[model samples]
Target: MIKNEANARHLREANKAFKAIKSEKPMTDYAKAQQSIQENRERLKAERLAREVSSKDAAK
Candidate 1:
């Protein structure tokens, strides 16, 4: 019954994918790997500050 169902379906799927990929900020593998290093530095800094606070409290 449908003459252009395959073409129409392909169009719809392609259009649906366009939006999902549109807003992505592409990062290379090295960039993605470096992000974790920054995160770890932040985490370690927070942990060091927490320990310092606890040590000061214990000293008092």
Candidate 2:
């Protein structure tokens, strides 16, 4: 649960960063957006793994 929450927090932060970058000058930085997206994906994967483990333990 804690890991899930942390992951969510990271995602939210990434979203904010994306928005900020998007709102900047005319040119948008695809690299920064891509990095943030990748980080978000990794965090989500960690959260999913944690949930899977917890669920499996509960089932047992």
Candidate 3:
């Protein structure tokens, strides 16, 4: 009776924790991917500008 109730409570708590952890995983991964893409874009833009500046200097 009491033991059964305790077991049920433990199971419920474990399930809730599992759900919370599972739900956050996709959001965390998406945020990391978005950050990586943003960093890559910034790096590409900087490189393009640097090349343009170098070409102009060479022309002068």
Backbone N/Cα/C clashes per model: 0, 0, 0
Q: Can you write out model 1's per-residue Cα lDDT over 1-60, one digit (the tens) per residue?
A: 375998898899988887565576789899988998999999999999999999999999
Residue 10 of model 3, lDDT score: 99
Ordered by TM-score, highest first, the candidates read 1, 3, 2
The root-mean-square deviation over C-alpha atoms between each candidate and the true structure, in angstroms, is 5.1, 20.3, 8.5
lDDT of 2 at 31: 75
lDDT per model vs. reference: 0.90, 0.90, 0.90
Query: Which pairs of residues collide in model 1?
Result: none
Which clashing pairs does model 3 show? none
lDDT of model 3 at position 59: 100
TM-score of each: 0.59, 0.53, 0.54
TM-score of 1: 0.59
Candidate 3: C-alpha lDDT: 0.90
Q: After superposing candidate 3, which stretches have Cα over 4 Å from the reference?
A: 1-27
